[model samples]
Target: MNSSQFEKIKNGKGFIAALDQSGGSTPKALAAYGVLEDAYTNDDEMFDQVHEMRTRIITSPGFDSSHILGTILFEQTMDREIEGKYTADYLADKGIVPFLKVDKGLADQKDGVQLMKPINDLDETLRRANERNIFGTKMRSVIHEANPSGIKAVVEQQFEVAKQIMAADLVPIIEPEVDIHSGEKEKCEDILHDELIQQLNALSENEYVMLKLTIPTKNNAYKELIEHPRVLRVVALSGGYSRDEANEKLKQNDGLIGSFSRALAADLRANHSGEEFDEALKSAVESIYDASVNKH
Candidate 1:
C-alpha cells in the first residue's frame, strides 16, 4: 500500500477488525459465534461458514459506521470471492483497507520463544494478494520473557521476513508479541524496546513500518519505538485477553491503535437478530476505537 493509504488507517478513528483465524481456530470461532459444535468437522466445511459470516458482517446495514479502518483476513478468506467480487474488493468498496496474514504459522521454539514459520511460496502469495488489491500483510512471532538473547532472535527473524515483505511492495505489520501472562512484564517490554531499536535502526531513513504489538505491561512502554523515524503506526493485539480486559488495558496505552482479533470480534457471531448483531458489532468497534485514539 502507499503512504497515503497507511496514513488514512493511522489517522482514522477506526481500528482494524481482525477476521484472520485459521486452522482449528476457525471451528472454535464458529462455535464461539454460536454455531452448533457438530456443525463442521474440517477446514472446508468451516471455511464456507466463515465466508458466510464475514459476508453477513460486510453487508450489514450499520457496519459502515462501525469505526473499522481495515480488516485482516486468513488465507482462505483472503482468496474467496462473493458473487463476482473478491472479498478485498468488497471491503475496499466500503472504504476499509484489507490486509492478509502471510506467515504460515509458528515454528518449534528456539531459546524458549516461538518464531513464525517462513511462508510457503510467498512470492506467489504476494502476487495473488496484490492482484486481488490487498493493501498490506501481517506476520506474527512471540516473545515469552525478558531473556535478551531470545528477544533478539525473535526480532531478527521477524525483521528479516519484514525486509523481504517490504521489498515486495506491501506494507508489513511486524508482530513480535510478548506473552502478557508472563512475569517481569515491564522488564520484557524493556528488552523488546531495545531489540526493536536494534532492528529498526537498520532501515533506510524514510522507510515506514507498521507494528502490531502485545499491549505493553506498562503504559507507553514502546513510546520511543513507536516514535522512531521508520515506524509509521503501531497497533496492539489482544494477546488472549477478554474483550473487557483488553479494552481496559488499552485505555492506559498511548499513541497506539488496535488491530485486535478476539476483542474486536468478541461480540460477533451466530444466532442473533440482524439488528442485534449490528448493534453488538458497532458497540465493540466503538469501544476499541475509543481506546485506540487515545494520545500520549
Candidate 2:
C-alpha cells in the first residue's frame, strides 16, 4: 500500500477484523475478511490449515481485497521459517497487507512490577521480517496500575518500542491495552481516557511519529470523540465480542474502526456455509462504515 492508502487506513474509520483459527477447523470464506489466522504451527496439519485460509481469502467475494489486512502470530510465523516469507508473499499477491503481532504474550507481573524481560533482539527480528516485505507489525504492553507512576512507566516503554519499530521501517500498532475484564464500563472509560492521554503525550514527545493503528476500547462517546482524532492515525476496536454484537458496536461508534476476535472465527465458518453469511457480514460492514460517515 502507498503512503496515502496507509494514511487512509490509519485515519479512516475502518475495521481490523480477525481470523484466529488458521490452524484449526476454520472454513475458507471467513479468512477472506481480514482474518488473523494462527498459521504459526509447525505441524503439517497446521500448514494445510494455513493454505486453506489463504485460498479462501483470495477467492472469497465477500472479502474486500483493498480493505483487508491479515495478521500472523510471531510464534507461528517464526517457527515455520520459509513459511513466514511465503505467507507474506501470498498475502501480498492476494492484495492483502500482512501484519505481524510482536508482543511476548502477556507479561507476568508481581506487586506492581512486571517480572518478564523485554523482547530481546527485536531489531534483528524486525530486520529479517522487513526483508520478507511484511507490511506492518503490532506490539502490545499492559499498564497494570492506574496511578501516575505506573502510567508514566507504561508510556515510556511504549514510546521506546515504537521508536525501535519505526526505525526498522515498520508501521507500529501501539496498543496500551487496559484490560476491560477488570472494571465496569464507567471505570473502564476512566482508565482508557487516562491511558489515551498519556500515550498521545509520549507519541507527541517523539515528534508525533506515524503509526499504523491504535486498538482501544470504546468507553464514552464524548471521550472517544475528543481523543480519537488526537492520538493515532486510526482508532481500532478491541477484541472480545461476537460478530453480531461487534457489528452493532461498530454501528454505534459510526466512523470508528472495528477489530475482532471470536467474531472473526465465527464469520469465517459462516462464510463456508454460503450466501447467507456473506451477505450478512458485508451488509453489516458497509452499513457501519456508512453510518459512521453519515454521523460526521
Candidate 3:
C-alpha cells in the first residue's frame, strides 16, 4: 500500500470522481454526454467512444487532484492508455489517486435488494489492479426497501468482499446504495446505518474501510459511521438526484463527500468544443467540491 495515497484519501479535502460506467450503464452515460446509441456500431466501437470521453475528461484542465481527490475506473479504462501512459499512471501523475470498479455488476433484486454478482476472478482482478498502481476498489449493491434481512445481507456481502480487497492491501469503498426512489427510504437508511455500524464495530482497530452511500433522508444520518475508527471516510453517491439536488443535500452532511457520476456530468455535452467542455467540467467540479469540502 502507498501510505501517501492512503493518507490523501483519509484526509483529502475533495470528492472522488466516479467515471467507472461499465458495460451495463455505459450507453446511458454516453447518451447523457450526447453520444446516442446510433453513434456506435458495435461494442468495440462503443467502448472506444466512451474511452475517448474518459480520456478527454482526464486530460482536461478542469480535472485534477486539487478539487478531485480520486477517480474510479472501469476495467476497460484500466486496460487502456492515455497520453502514452497507462490510465492509472496518468491519474497518479495528475495527483489523483485511481480506483478500479471490480464487481461484475448487480444480481437480480431478491429479498427487495440487489446484491453484487459473484466476481469469479476477483483475485486476478486485484492482481491486475495492483500491477497498474491502482489505489483502491469500489463495488455496489442496492436496497429497494426497508427489509432488515435484505439490507443485512447486502451489508454482509459488501463486507465479505471488502475483506478480500483489504487483504490485497487496497482500500475498498463498500457501497450498499438504498434506492433513492424507495418508498421506505428513511427506514431503509436507518436499517442500513445500524447494519453498517455492526460491521464497522467488528473490524479490528488496524483495519480501515471507506463507504459510498446514497445521501440519507436525514442530515448527518451516517455521522456515527463517519466517526468510526475503522471507517476511513464516508462519501455520498448522487444516485438519481440531479446535480443541484445532490449538491444541496451533500452540503447538509458535514463529513460526507461526493462520488457522483450523472450529477458530475450533468452540464456537459458531447457536441461541445474543448473550451466549452472544460468550462462546464470546471463549473461542475467547483460546485461539487464546495458541497463536499466547504459545506455550510
Candidate 4:
C-alpha cells in the first residue's frame, strides 16, 4: 500500500468519485450523459462512449485532488489510458488515489437480497491493479429487505472477498448496500449496521477495511461503523437520489463522505462545450465536496 495515499484517504477532506459504472450499467450512464442508445450499436461501442465520458471527467481541470480525494474505476477503465498515461497513473499524477471495481456484478436476488457473483481471476485482477499503481478495490452487494439471514449472508460474503483483496496489500471497500427504496429502509440499515460491526470486529487486529453504504434514513445511523478502529473510512453511495437530495442528507452525517456516481455526474452532458463541461463539472464537484467536509 502507498503510505501517502493511505494517509490522504484516512484524513482527506473531499469525496470519492464513483466513475466505475460496469457493463450492465454503462448504457444507462451514457444515456444520462446525453449519449443515447442509438449512438452505440454494440457493447464495444457502448464502452468506448463511456470511456470517453470518463476520460473527459478525469482530464478536466475541475477534477483534481484539492476537492476530490480518490476515484473508483471500472476494470476496463483501469486497463485503458487517459492522455498518454494509464488511467490509474493519470489519477496518481493529479494526486488522486485510484481504486478498481473488482466485483463481477451482482447475482440474481435470492432471500430478498443480491450477492455479488463469483469473481473470476480475482488474483490476476489484483496483480494488474497493483502494477497500475491502483490504491484499492471496491465491490458491491445489495440488500432489499430487513431479513437477518439475508443481510448476514451479504455481509459475510463481502468480508470474505475483502480479505482476498486485503491479502493483495490493497484496501477494500466492502459495499453491502441496503437499497434506499426498500420498504423497510430504516430496518434494513439497522440490520446492516449491526452485521457490518460484527464483521469488522472479527477482522485481525492489523487488518483494515473501508465501507460504502447507502445514506441511511436516519442521521448518523452508521456512526459506530464510521468510528470503528478497523474501519479506515466510511463513504455513502448516492443510490438513486438526486444530487441536491443526496447532499442534503449527507450534511447531516458527521463522518461519512460521498462516493456518488449518478449524482456526481448529474449536471454534465455529452453535448456540452469544453468550457461548459468544465464549469458544470466544477459545480457538481464543489457541491459534493462541501457536503462531504462540512458536517451538520
Candidate 5:
C-alpha cells in the first residue's frame, strides 16, 4: 500500500472524518456515495443523468471532498478511454475518490452450496486503476444460510483477493453480502456477523480496510442485531432502498458509508425542482455522524 493509503487506514479516520468534517452546524454527512446499474447500462441518457447526480453530490453543501468515495462499475471504467478519461479522473476532478466494484455479482446458492466464479483480472485491473489514480477497489463475497461450506470457500477467496489487492498497493473494501431476499432480518444479521468474523480471521495477516454490509440494519429485528467488537474503519449500507430506508439503516450502522441507489436517483430528480430532498438526506446523515462520534 502507498504510504498515504496506509496512514489513512492506520489512522482509521477516513470514514469518520468524511462524516464529521462538514461545518459544525451543517446537517450533512456522506462518507461515500455510489452510482449503480443505471450508471453502467451503456446508455447516453442514463450516463448523463448519473454524471449530473455526481455533480450534485460533490457540490452539495458540507459534503467533504476528501471523504467522498464514488463506486464506479466496470463498464463505466471500461468505456472511459473511448468515451472520456477514466471515471476516476472525472471523479477526481470533482474531488471525489473513485472505487471500482470488482465482484461479478451475487453467487447462486442452492442445496446448501454456492457456486462463485472469479470475475476480474486483479493484477491488470489494479494496474489500470492505479494508473488512473482511482481511490480504491472493492470486491464482494456472499454468504447464505444454507451454504456453510460455501461460506468458508467465499471467506478463503476474500482473503486471497485481499492479499492480491495489498500486493497491488490498493485499499480493498471487503464486502460480504447477506442478501435481504432471505426472509428474516435476524437470520440475515446472524449470518452476516458470522461471515464477517470468518473473513476477518482469514485476513488477520492482511490489512483489510473496510467492511461493506448489504443492509446493515433490520426492520423486524433491530434489537437482536449486535455490533462486532473490533472497530470497522468503514461500513457501507448497500443500495436498492428508499431514502427513508437508507437513513434508517445508516442510523443502525453507526455512521458508516452510505451507499444509495434509488434514493440517490430520486434525489437527483428532486434537484431539478429545487426540492428539500437534499436537506432531508443531509439531515439524516448528520444525525448518524453525530450519534456515532458521541458514542466514540
Candidate 6:
C-alpha cells in the first residue's frame, strides 16, 4: 500500500465494524432474525436478508464517522445502492472508509487449523474495489489450539493473501482468531506472537500490515507487535463475548481497538422505530468508543 492509502486507514483510528459475513455466516444471522434456512429457495438466499441487515447497519441512527472509522462489506453489499446512493460512496461521504471482505469463507478443517477459503476471483474483486475506491480489505482464519504448527499455518495463509491484497493498494486486516474458550488462550497468544514476528521478517522491506486478533488472554500479549513499526494498528474481535464483556476486555487492551460485529451491533432489531434504533446504536457506539480510546 502507498503512503496515501496508509494515511487513509490511519485516519480510521482503529474502529472497524465488520459486517462482512459470508454466505455460511449469513444463514445463522438470518435464523437469529427468525428466518429459517429451509424457507429459502436456494442456498445463497440468506444474502438477500444480509443485505437488509447491512442496510440497517449503515443507515442505523447515530452511525457517523466518529462512531465507526470504517465498515467491512460483504461482496454483495459492496455493490449495493441504498436510496440511490452507492455503498462505497455512501460511506466515504460520511467519512467512514469502506473495506471489502475478499476471502470466500473457510475451507474444511485441516490438521486442526481452519483456513479461509481462497478467493479464486480475487484479482477481479480487487480491481473492482480499486475502481470503487475501497480503502482496504479483510480476511479471517481460525486458530483452535496452541499448536505451533496450526498457528503457523493460519499465519502463513493470512500473510500469503495479505501480500497480494497490499499489492492491490488496499490495506489488509489479517485476522487469525484464536478461540477464546480454548484452555490454551495464553499459550496460543505467545505462539501466535512469535509466529507473527517471524512471518513479518520474511516480508519485503518496508511492507506494512494491520492485525485483527481475538482479544488475547493478557491485555498486552502482543506488546512487541503493537510497537512494531510495520504494524499500523492492532485491533480485537469479540470472540463470542457479549457486548458488555467485549467492552471490558477491549478497554483493558492498551493498544487494540475493536473490529467487532456482534458487540458493536448489539441486539439492534429490524423492527425498532427510527428513534429507538438510533438510541440503541448511539449507546453501542459510545460504549465501544470509550473502550477504544488509548489509555496507555
Candidate 4, residues 1-296, lDDT tens digits: the string is: 99999999999899999999999899889989999999989999998999999999999999989999999999999999999899999999999999999999999999889999999899999999999999999999999988999999999999999999999999999999888889999999998888898889999987899999999899998899999999999999999999999999999999999999999998899999999999999999999999999988
Task: Write model 2 residue lDDT over 8-48, tens digit each, in one string.
Answer: 45554445544334333343333544433453344565455
Q: Which consecutive 10 residues in model 4 have the weakest lDDT in total?
A: 190-199
Task: Give all candidate RMSDs, comma-separated.
Answer: 1.8, 5.9, 0.7, 0.8, 8.1, 2.1
- For residue 137, give model 4's deviation from the true position in Å: 0.5
In candidate 4, how many Å is residue 126 off? 0.7
Global Cα lDDT for candidate 2:
0.51
For model 1, the stretches where C-alpha displacement exceeds 4 angstroms are none
Error of 5 at 159 (Å): 2.7
| Model 6 stretches with alpha carbons more than 4 Å out | 1-5, 11-14, 33-45, 294-296
Q: Best to worst by lDDT, what's the order?
A: 3, 4, 1, 6, 2, 5
Q: Which residue runs does candidate 4 get wrong by more than 4 Å?
A: none
- The TM-score, computed over Cα atoms with residue i paired to residue i, of candidate 4 is 0.99
Q: Residues 67-122, candidate 1: write the lDDT tens digits.
A: 77888888788788865788888888888888999888888877757888767688
Please estimate how well model 6 matches the true structure, expressed as its whole-model Cα lDDT: 0.80
**Deviation of model 6 at 149, angstroms:** 1.3
Q: How accurate locally, in lDDT, is each candidate?
A: 0.81, 0.51, 0.95, 0.95, 0.50, 0.80
Counting only residues 3 or more apart in sequence or on different chains, how many pairs clash (N, Cα, C under 3 Å) in candidate 5? Answer: 0
lDDT tens digits, residues 164-277, model 6? 888887888898888888888889889999999988778776677889898888877888887787787888888899988888888887777888887877667767777877
Model with the higher lDDT, candidate 4 or 6? 4
lDDT of 3 by residue, 139-228 (tens): 999999899999999999999999999999999999999899999999999999999999999998778999999999999999999999
> Once superposed on the true structure, which residue ranges of model 3 sit more than 4 Å away at CA?
none
